[model samples]
Target chain A: MATLEIRDLHVSVDAENGPREILKGVDLTVKQGETHAIMGPNGSGKSTLAYSLAGHPKYTVTGGSVLLDGEDVLEMSVDERAKAGVFLAMQYPVEVPGVSVSNFLRTAATAVRGEAPKLRLWVKEVKEAMAALQMDPAFAERNVNEGFSGGEKKRHEILQLELLKPKIAILDETDSGLDVDALRIVSEGINRVRSTGEVGTLLVTHYTRILRYIQPDYVHVFAGGRIVESGGAELADKLENEGYEAYVKGGASE
Target chain B: MAEQNTTGSTTAGSIEVGTAGAGAQLAGPGTGRTTVHQPIDARVAVKPSFDVNDFPVPTGREEDWRFTPLHRLGGLHDGTAAAGERGEDKVGFTLPDGVTAETVGRDDARLGKAGTPVDRVAAQAFSGFEQALVVTVPKDAVLTEPVRIDVRGEGGVRFAHVVIDVKPFAEAVVVLNHEGTGTRAANVELLVGDGAKLTFVSVQDWDRDAVHAAQHSALVGRDASYKSVVVTFGGDLVRLHPRVSYAGPGGEAELFGLYFADAGQHLEHRLVIDHDTPHCRSNVAYKGALQGQDAHAVWVGDVLIRAAAVGTDTYELNRNLVLTDGARVDSIPNLEIETGEIVGAGHASATGRFDDEQLFYLQARGIPADEARRLVVRGFFAELLQQIGVAEVQDQLMEKIDAELEAAV
Candidate 1:
């Protein structure tokens, strides 16, 4: 099975006093065709985990390593890791003022594929994909994320995920700012892509509303930079009902 | 020093005077004195109605030339002339149909007059053209290609003038390229008729020893539109002054510029947008990057919204990126609004280092530090390329920027 494995990953941001540890020995794994949801409260290093796995320089990996199908992922650059079938739907995608969505998508796709997409067919395909997500065709002409509404930026991230067609995607708080309608649209889009591509998915979120749309194969509770517990899809239901207090109090004794 | 008389008194109120002629006093460094030269009735062969003496000397005192590097003058302004060679003409850049370049000017008249406001001077060493190459777009003519003007320099100083006229309802895109070596000067005049549209792009990519001075003036008529883009790449010193006026109602003007200065190069751009008539719109955006020790760049943008120019919409911005520790960029955006009740009139100017977040993002993407920096610079310029509107021209510009980035690293 194609698997992404994170082994006792320790991370920190460099400080004059020494490295201030952020993620302390966090471990997790997911296989292809599987959907894993990581639920955690604020300041639990969830975003740090996503950024570190994506090779963001600010979140240094002080110990351990990340591997994709036995290949060391920490060794690859950000774009290289992305090209190697790993996509991170950023929590806040930076707005590139002068780059149009069409242009940015074309370049990213071209970079991932190592060749230019066919000109005539490229336009038609992009239009169709945008339509599938219920996004306006005019959005393609606008600068990437520039002047976009909060929901629009989130939808844009999903659009890139659909177009880039990565093997596995780690979505960081993709549902944070999305409204009910936008969240539904975003969930539907994710479902459509996963069903079609049969790719592995890792959903990082604090809410359970999105779980109703895309049922997770497994749910893991994260606290203190480590996975405290792992269970079936019912685990998400438990967290949604009981909250993280039970796990937090239980983990306090460990 | 012995007295040297360059030019003697020719007539009453008219003097055949050369500041370089013996007896003409030259200013030395640390001399706080500013000499005011007597205005001479200067005559240029082409466009005799326009007087070259009225042009001001770009001193640091003027708001328009404040950001310019006056220290680079280094005693080079004393009687320095441009090398003018009238050989076979060549054209670059794809041009639309019905537009062509022709040489114009008489033997006694040359384009390009230099100096500060008081000591206004014209390059006399360069030969004058009897007839300036004219690019005429007939009335109702709509062009599908972009016209290119290729100006080449070998050595010394060269002066050439080109006049472009767009008749009513005519549309065209014109590109002028200054390539080769030595010091060169040019004056470009664009006259657009009512309801006409014209886009002009000037690219200065000369050899290391080259010094370029260019003046662009446009007279836009009622309901007409004019757009100009200037790119400065290679040169020891390059200065461009672009003046545009909406002389009639419903006119629109856009001025866009991008420059990349390497080590030891100094580039300056001065832009003036005059909103003379009502319902006119003008937008100006200029961006630049300076790298290497002592590489300096400047951008001066002035937008004048006269009282008569009601309902005018004007916006301007200048952004510069300093790559090296010793690199510097100075920018000034000036907006003069006469009427309080106007539609949108403002400007912004900024000069700083590369954004750390952008750099980190690119580096995380697997691009090395150098390549990542190049990507950021390229992306910074991509803003202009997006507005170029022409595929071939845009591709060529991108390629040129890529070459510059490669060599710069």
Candidate 2:
């Protein structure tokens, strides 16, 4: 079974003088066919976790290791990690103007599959995926994430997750800018793709609305670069009702 | 072959000069024309290395020479003298195996192409380097690695011309680099045979005080493809003219340019795609960024679908980003389609400042304002870089261009 393990992972950026630690000894384990939602407020290293896993150069991994199915993730390059069945649906997807979505998808899909997809079958698969997302076929011809609305960008990310079929998908605040209709469409797309029981997901978010669409097996509250609380699905409701002020102050005092 | 040398000095400067349009259509005797003349010893200017004929002068009437700077001929001279010896440090980039570079003067027997008349007046007046270096990629040759050619100009008036011949079924990437700290003008001719493909890159990183000028002429035959990418970041007055023609059916050509101009720099790019046959296609895209006082850049793209070029499909676009009040960019895209049976023909040109909406979007996403602008610029140029298709080279170029963008802002 596929798995994602982050053990004492630390990260930093290159500021003037020296590196500043961003991720401080954060540990987490996500198994295949499981949904784990990491809830956190703004500026609490949520996106940093996503970038550190994606091998963004600005975020240096000062210590700790990321493993996938017992293989060291830190040893792989960004593209290599991508090929190793690790996918990050960026909270703010990088807008690649002049690169068609279909073309970019095929390239990334080809990289994951270890070979170029057959032209005929690839077209059919992309069309079917677009239909499943209720997206116009012409969107594939448009540049990747270029001029896409807020909800469209999120849905596009889920569309990629569905088509690429990664072993462990990382959704970093994918629901932040989405509206109610967009959230439902995006979450429905995710649910349909994960229903096959072949993929696991780590859903990083702050809202519980998305969780209502796609249920999580485990809910973890992240504060001060570490998980402060872990519980079943009911934990998300409690946090939503009580707010994060108490936990944030309690963690800060420690 | 004999060496002739001449040394002369002339002083000419023009202030409050109007913008020189791409097609030289200003319509005045002194608008874009100037002449300079000074007397000096003849021995210092001559190049007698191999042998070449002096190119002829133009009356400012020829189609190819119409849009060029014509008034700089007052201080020009001709010579057959050998060039001054320079150490290896002056020249960079070792040639690949099986490739040969020979330095030949104007008097050489192979100076000009067969059946082409020599322009003696223009050759003597416009030549910058003393000798011409010719490189050849043999027939059926496939170079797994790129060939680097560095043309270094030490000082004084220098002119160099490079001739490249890619034989049939051959594939290669030829990087012609212009690097030096003096006045320079280099001309290059690329000839690709049937069923051959060539990715030619011209990187202009000349000294900031240098006046750089170049002309690239290429001919693509049946089933052949050619892609030229020009990146210019240095030089006081740099101008590149790329003239390409498709000689047979099913031929393709792409012209791409990226330029950044800062204070006191004037960079210009002129491209012409001549579709002489049916079923040929050509595309041109040139983008630039300009900042600071008197920073000016021009892009003129012309696609000509001749009468015989039925079924031809051509498109061209020129976009510029102006970053300062004193900076300016001029873009002109033209399409002249003679045949009505063509597949498609379109052209577009636009000039605008940074988009405030995009900046706000990125800033609202938690990116600092400055870094947000950087990301927007990266996102803007990423489309072009991705099309370059060479991962390592693209990454390296991206890092360098990113640094330039950061420094500019």
Candidate 3:
């Protein structure tokens, strides 16, 4: 079992005028086998928290302590954090030209597993995983994300998540730009990993439609760069009806 | 040529210049629609000659020589490097069945039939070499294996000439491999007969202290096809020019090049595709990677479509990847068109550093930084390596590329 803890996490980004703080005194905790949905409006710094844990160079941790099973997550390099079982499914995955999907998956699997997988078994594993997601077998031969459609990019990110099998998986707006069919396919993929009961999921999004597919153990209403309220799955239904207007007004006043 | 003029008079007379990135197409009325005239630009009007005196010695100021380091040419630009005798081991050839190789004197009737010398070094090489190696394929024959020619230098000054002739309806592949150290100037001529197909590969794997300058010219007959792959990896200073011209309509040509420049290495490639016949097609793609301080690579692509050459199609692309600081790349693409009745014409050039986002994307998957860099660099050159068409050479080139990347660290 693994757990990720973020305490008083304050993050800032360099702006035209000066350094601007985005995440202000945010605190969260996610344990294995649990799904946490962080819902927020535009510019609420929800994605900031996702990228901060991934060690993105754009975001700086001003004052915070991120611990993954008592290890200093904040001090780890991006790849080191990944080797420690942390994965980030970016909102907009980058295009890597000339790198075929099959080669990329194999290389990533080798790095994470600390040993090369048997070619015969690995090929079967990839084919089965691709078929489960309704992906065409020919996609394995294409360059990663090169000229891929929006839905296809999202599917590729989920594919990586399924293969890497990280301890802490952060899905940043994975449901955005996905059609109904694609959303179901990607959600099913995540559920397959979740069913393993060895992974913690942090799903960040602006809409509650994804909640219809994957239920969360806890729901956090994010506003003004921090989680304003936290509750069970019932809080999501409240936000869907009451909206974030009350919290936004309160955050601005403070 | 007169028949083409008669046909050109009936078409719309206009000139168009299409800039790749700007998406700007400038069209204007052409002068003397029926009469095909060369552009007044001096750079495109240099007449081909066989005499050294007809071309002046380069002074590092000419448009063709400006990017080249004249001092590092080891006197190939002038008459200072005298021709030296090479041992029997200096040049070797492995020919397949139905292919013939022989050394002939300058009086041979087929010498210089493909092209005449366009520069002083080439002209000097033409007038200096006592013997030329000629490889010929019979008519209507297709060889299953490729013809290999290995040229090894033992540290001397030499001038050389080579000719490859493919008869009508014949098909063949040729590989010219260069290695070892020397100061050399040479000329290569390729002749493709009507309905014939030829694929020629020239590799410059010279020693680190070697200096080489060469010009390759190909003449494609009616309905013939020609493909050339130029690979340059090992050299202190190497400059090569590959030019193509069609003999009749329905001819096609493809030129592909790959180069890797290490520290203190200078590699340059200049190409020209002359479309003087109707309905001929040509394509050019060249890619290079530069690493370490003082590593430089230059690529210049020039394509000209005359007024009488109706229904011409051409496109050229050049891309460079800079692996480290202190490396320089100069890429230029020039397209001149005189007929508006063509299918298409375009060119593109881009030079960029290793993308940080790509590196991050790989690293985020647990790949180390150095391994990520290698993956990206290998991916950058993967497409061109496949075009080489030789499995053994491709594997060797990959190993060389990996070694280059290892040294960069």
Q: Alpha-carbon error at A56 in model 1, in Å? A: 0.6
Chain B TM-score of candidate 3 stands at: 0.88
DockQ head-to-head 1 vs 2, winner = 1
As a whole number from 0 to 100, the lDDT of residue B288 in candidate 1 is: 90
TM-score of chain A of each: 0.95, 0.96, 0.97
lDDT (tens digit, per residue) of candidate 1 on B1-409: 1111123212111112222111122231122444311111122112111333334434566544455555554222333342233333344534466665555554322222111112222222122334555677889999887777776776654456676878899988888887887655556768778999998888898887677666677878899989888999988888787877665789888888999988889898877676656899888888899989888887767666656667888887788888988987766565555665467776667777877666554443334567667767887898878887878778888999999999885
State the lDDT of candidate 2 residue by residue for B211-285, as single tens digits. Answer: 666667677878888888888888777777776776579988888888888987888887767666799888787
Off by over 4 Å in 3: A250-254, B1-45, B83-89, B387-393
Number of the top-ranking candidate, with TM-score as the measure? 3
The digit string of per-residue lDDT tens for model 3 on A133-206 reads 88999999888898999888988998889888999999999999999999999999999999999999999999
Ranking the candidates on TM-score from highest down gives 3, 1, 2
How far in Å is the alpha carbon of B317 misplaced in model 3?
0.8
DockQ of 1: 0.24
The lDDT values for all models are 0.72, 0.69, 0.84
Task: Identify the superior model by lDDT, candidate 2 or candidate 3.
Answer: 3
Model 2 chain B lowest lDDT segment of ten: B35-44
Residue A88 CA displacement from its true place in model 2, Å: 20
Which ranges in model 2 have alpha carbons more than 4 Å from their true place? A1-144, A147-152, A156-254, B1-89, B107-130
Better of 1 and 2 by lDDT: 1
User: Best by DockQ, which number?
Assistant: 3
